[model samples]
Target: MHWIKTLKYYLKSLGPGFIIASVVLGPGSITVSSRIGSEHGYAFLWVILLAAISMVIYTSMGSRFGVSNKDSILQSIAGNYGRWFSAVIGIAAFLAASSFQFGNNLGVGIAMEGITGVDERVWPLIFTPLAIVLLFWAKNLYKLLEKLMMVLVMVMIVAFFFNLVLTKPDVGEIAKGFVPSSFSFDSLDIIAALVGTTFVLHGALYQSYLAQKRGWKVGDIKKGLSDSYTGISLLALISVLIIITSASALYPNGITVNSAADMALQLEALFGSYAKVIFSIGLCSAAFSSLMVNAVMGGGLLADGLGLGSTMDEKMPKIFTTIALLMGMLIAVFFRGNIIYTLILAQASSILAVPLIAIGMFLILNNKKVMGKLKNNLWQNVLAVFGFLLISIMVYFMYGKIITYIQSLS
Candidate 1:
């Protein structure tokens, strides 16, 4: 009975983690994971494990920051590190979120288009306004977003798991994939994608805000840790499932999908028409969830960065949120391209602000004054540094690619 009570308490402490999980497990995650699995056949499963550890480390830092400080993260940073640095993080996060916002809008439309043949462009026009309405009109925006993410994350779990089940993967091969086989330089692109998608600093940074919204305190760190584990575990499980499903279903036949929606549509040839529908439903869930939450994160962080306000119930956060929402929709409608835009956005983020966002939480967590007794332990520090180095390497390769991409544009 006591154990049952403990489980219930942890369950009750679940909102914030779901938010992180839902945003990380977005359409981009699915597409990239699918590509890795389809082309490499689970050769890089170890990357997800490494990323999960990195994610857990930073997420815990964010959670600690949320509980240890009464002020928003940006506000705390301002006091300790100066407002200019905090503003950089805030602006970078907003731009990163805004850039990805384009893909999410198109993803929602594409997934719907795959199912109903409704013409992909039309869905974004409808969904974006609907997202704005909910973002502005919803009472207790934090709780609403939390519950919404929970539902969406579960939908993603069920949908992706369904696809995995259809693949009927080899458990032994999947296990062996975790043992990190040596690969060539050709694999760097996929490895980077897997890391970039999973070890996401932006989503981890938002964990602080989410924890604050949950009204967690010092006493609730245990629950916060539990929530972090649960969310990242869900994230890992979904990514692994997507990989195995694609590896089993497509790798053998050398069928690489251009989009996640394309993966669903192609599955129809192997399974049945309904397979595509189920996958599309999952894809739509991922996109719509990301479309709404990404804007909120961008808006709220940028608002607080500009010294407007932080809390969701406040006018400024919602106003900024609306701007992000509109920005994504407009970009998606105007450009109407998917793959190139996603790569550019991903690169832009890494180059612009992710390195700072990744390092900021570690600095804050380790500071004796700011974190006090909640300061990160030695193992956390070691892992955080390792994570930072990994990201630095990722950025190196990405910088070269960005240069080539830009030159091609001109």
Candidate 2:
């Protein structure tokens, strides 16, 4: 009976990290890691490590604020910035995130078609309804779903590492990725995509909301922190693994892969056409899981903005799910012509948001009035400021490239 109790307790402790990992494993991660592998080989693996450390710091702040104070970072921000400013941020985030989800969903579908040789256009039609159903199935039921995604993560790890071991990637070159090197136009973009990912708001926001949803209390702070750290660590490991697998197989071959599907095709050479099958299995899990999280986050944000947090009913989840799914599909259908634009928006959202969110949290955490004795110490402040600085630099450089690219086209 004691053993059973322990097992149940451990299982319950797993949710927060599972949620964070699910969002982190989505399209941005898949493509960026694959590109890093194909372009720089194992040389970019360290970027994921650095980015993971940043995400750990980022998610921890969200988890701490919610569990300790029983209020969200957004709520704190609203109090500081005024309700109107907070409302504007929410609206902009919703539109931007919705647009980004479209790209993520379409990327998943395209990868599925590439793996299965089916029509890409038809894939979204099938997935749209499925995604909606999964999102609203039950808030409590996400535990089981999280467990399933954990299994999927394991499978992906095995599939990737197995191939990586067979190739015997150069450890020496992989180590070189950690040391800062001269940046070129291409290297800067890949680094931006790598580190820019840490700034994305969805994963951290999910951490905040999930901590609140789980009834985690001030007493649960240590547990919440441990769970969040685990999740972010797993996410970081997956990020590094994706880069290592891609770099080992694609870079030496001089192969160029511009999309997830292209990466899948290239992986076929390493793991066989069955690599596509494995990738789709992973992609579907990633896409649907992230979709469910975004649906919940967006809907909750909408409800919170309207002061209707408690008014959300059983139907609210389903309605929000439908809204998100439809919005994503519409973007897929209408904006299919410009993949670059969609990709830029998806990556840029996080890059632009991270610094602001970081600054806000630093203020909130250090407020001796708000946190009292629980405020961040000097080391935490230093790390947070450094992370903010790193993300700001990446954003500045990436924005330049985007402008240059646009000018060339004009």
Candidate 3:
């Protein structure tokens, strides 16, 4: 009976982390993981392991910050630094959210199009408005978003795990992937993609808000850690499954995965039709779940940064969230130019904002006055410095590629 009560408490405390898992593992992430699996085989599985460790460390920081402070992340920035500091974080978040929102819009539409035989372009028209309606319709936005993300996370696990079981990935090769000697500069670009997609500090920043939204307090740290671990582990596990599935099914055949859809089509060619449907189910879940939460994170941050209001039911947050959805939908529907390039640019800009956000978060968590008893431990501080250096290296690596890509276009 006591164990059952403990289980109920754990279940009740399980919202923010699951949201982090679902929102971070969006279509773009799936595509990146697929490409890594197909091109590099299991050799780079260590990257996901590295990313999961880094994310768990950072998200733990975010969760503590959420419980330790009554203010939003941005509001805390304003108090300690100034309004200008918070504003910078807010605007950057909104721009990045709005930009990547295009992909989510296109993603949901694409997943539907793949299944329903409708043009992907037409599907966003129907779905984006529904997202807006969902924003307005929710009496308590956090509860709704949490429940929705849970279902999506379960969908991804089931759909991708089913395919993974089918692949029968080489147990020995997969084991070798965990050895760091397998890493190489040749795969540095995809390595950055994996890290950027997984060690998403922006999502970490949002974790604080989600915790507070759950009505968490300083005493809830144990439960918060539980949720964080569960969420991050699921994220790493699902990503590994996607990569493993591709490595087994496509890497040996030398099929390059250009998209999530590419992985599905190629899987079907090898494993028959069920592969496509199963993979597509995972894709749809990823896209739709990300579609809603992207706006919530972006708009909520923007409003708080601007000193408008971070609460979703508030007028400003809703307006900003709706704008994010519309921005993505219009670009997804009306853009006649190169789609992938646009997504890359959007994501790149967002990645650029992460260092500032991460540094600010670290400072807050370390502040004795701010965190009190929760201030940074020796291990957390060590990881923060190390993570910073790693991110600096990645940014340099990614920036060079973006420059070369643009130069090629010119």
Question: Total backbone clashes of model 2?
Answer: 1
Q: Global lDDT for candidate 3? A: 0.83
Which lDDT tens digits does candidate 3 get at residues 1-410? 99999998888779999998887887777877887899889878898898888889889998998888888878888899889988888887777566567778777876886777688899889888888888998788788889989999999999999999888889999999888876678767767777866787778889999888888899999988889999999999998999899999999999988766778889889888888888888888998888889888888888988999978878898888888888888888987666655554445445655777778888888888889999899999998877777676777787777777778778
C-alpha TM-score for every candidate: 0.95, 0.87, 0.95
| lDDT winner between candidates 1 and 3 | 3
Residue 116 lDDT in candidate 1? 96
lDDT by residue (38-130, candidate 2, tens digit) is 877766666666777777876787787778776666676677666664555455445435645765677767766766778776777777877
CA-lDDT, candidates in order: 0.82, 0.67, 0.83
- The regions of model 2 sitting more than 4 angstroms off are 1-11, 136-148, 182-186, 305-321, 338-345, 402-410
Pairs of colliding residues, candidate 1 = none
| CA lDDT for candidate 1 | 0.82
lDDT of 1 by residue, 1-410 (tens): 99999888777779888888877777777888887788789789999999899998888889988988898888888788888877888888887787667778777888898899998889889999999889778877778888888888898889888888888998898998998884567766677778866787878889999998888999999989889988988988888989999999999999987777778877888989888888888889888888888888888888887778887788898888899888878877877344744643463344345788876777778889888999999998999998888777777777777677668777
